[model samples]
Target: MSTLKSRLDVVEQKISEAASNSGRSRDDITLVVVSKNNPAQMVLDLAEIGVSNFGENRDQEAKPKAAEVALAGKTVTWHFVGQLQSNKAKSALSYSSVLHSLDRPSLLDAVGKAVADRAEPLDVFIQLNLTDDQNRGGIQTQNVLGFAEQVLQTPNLRLLGLMGVAGLDVDPRVDFDRIRNSSEQLMRLAPDAKYISAGMSEDFEFAIASGATHVRIGTAITGKRPY
Candidate 1:
């Protein structure tokens, strides 16, 4: 097997084990390869290795890279996982199959406008900031339900579900619980929004146990990224 393929095997094994331990089907979880700063060729390489879903955090990079992947004739789902500004929403709408960071009303407005103009319904996740830190970009827990309600009402947008990151200072298990709880609340508000996107290279197992349908993993398969 090629080196990248070998690494991918290990990661898949870990995911399977995590699912087994959690008593959930491995197929229930989707792996979203985070390709933020990675080159388009790397994404193509991953696609060649049977990876069909990838995520990027910056529109400037993600927009073109997504186009490149499409041009290369690879079938892949591109997720935008960043704090999207209003101005960049149009560019992001062009390529992202799912927008994973809808944190504010202005962003929602921009996305609604962009999608309406294109007449495409984009999948959107309301980011929840479980941490006490305000610096983090997410709808506060208290406001999330109302915000999610609003998002569901927005035109040309499908409320896919919730997304979050474990707080830097909190235990992964604890944060995973918080995220799962938030997801549960979101589901109560919007029953159709079933996706819970959380976890990364470190705490994906915890996330799976907490009912994450999607996990964003980096480094483990791609190796260390250059800063």
Candidate 2:
């Protein structure tokens, strides 16, 4: 078997075990393999192996890669998983079916305008800052619900719950628990918003146990990134 395929198998096995340990069905969790700096050919190879959900981080790199995959006739769900800017809202929305980093309310109108004429509404996650640091990309945890309500007010955007990066200096369990609680709080306002998109390749096991419906895994599945 190819090395990449083998790598994918290992990650899936880990996810399955994590789900089992959490007393949750593997079906309840969606593995969003991050393909940020990876080549489109690599993504196609993963598609051939039944990986339909892929996450990309940057607009400039992601747009062309998503186009390449589409041009090849492969059915892939592209997610934009980086910090978003209102200026690139339209272009970023053009290639992504989901944006995992909707931390600002200002981009709501931009995203709505971009998808206004489209047949489908865009799925967005209100990213939250889990650390005490203010330099991070997510909205403050306390402000997540307020921003989520704003997202709900937009006509063309669908609130898909919250996304966050665990603090580098903190414990995985703490961050995951906080995120799960945050999801519960968000649901009080937006009932349908139960999806928790926390965790990464390193802490995904803990994340799954904490009620993460979606996990963005990268190196564990795609091998080490070149960039």
Q: lDDT of all predictions, in order shown?
A: 0.87, 0.88
After superposition, candidate 2 runs with Cα above 4 Å error: none
Off by over 4 Å in 1: none
lDDT of 1 by residue, 153-175 (tens): 88789998899998778888897
> Which candidate should be chosen as best, given lDDT against the real structure?
2
Model 1's lDDT to the true fold?
Answer: 0.87
Candidate 2 residue-wise lDDT, 85-187, digit = tens: 8899999989799999987767777888888987889998989888777877788888887787778988878888999888788898998899999999999
Window of ten residues with lowest summed lDDT in model 2:
218-227
TM-score of each: 0.95, 0.96
Report, for all candidates in order, the number of backbone clashes. Answer: 0, 0
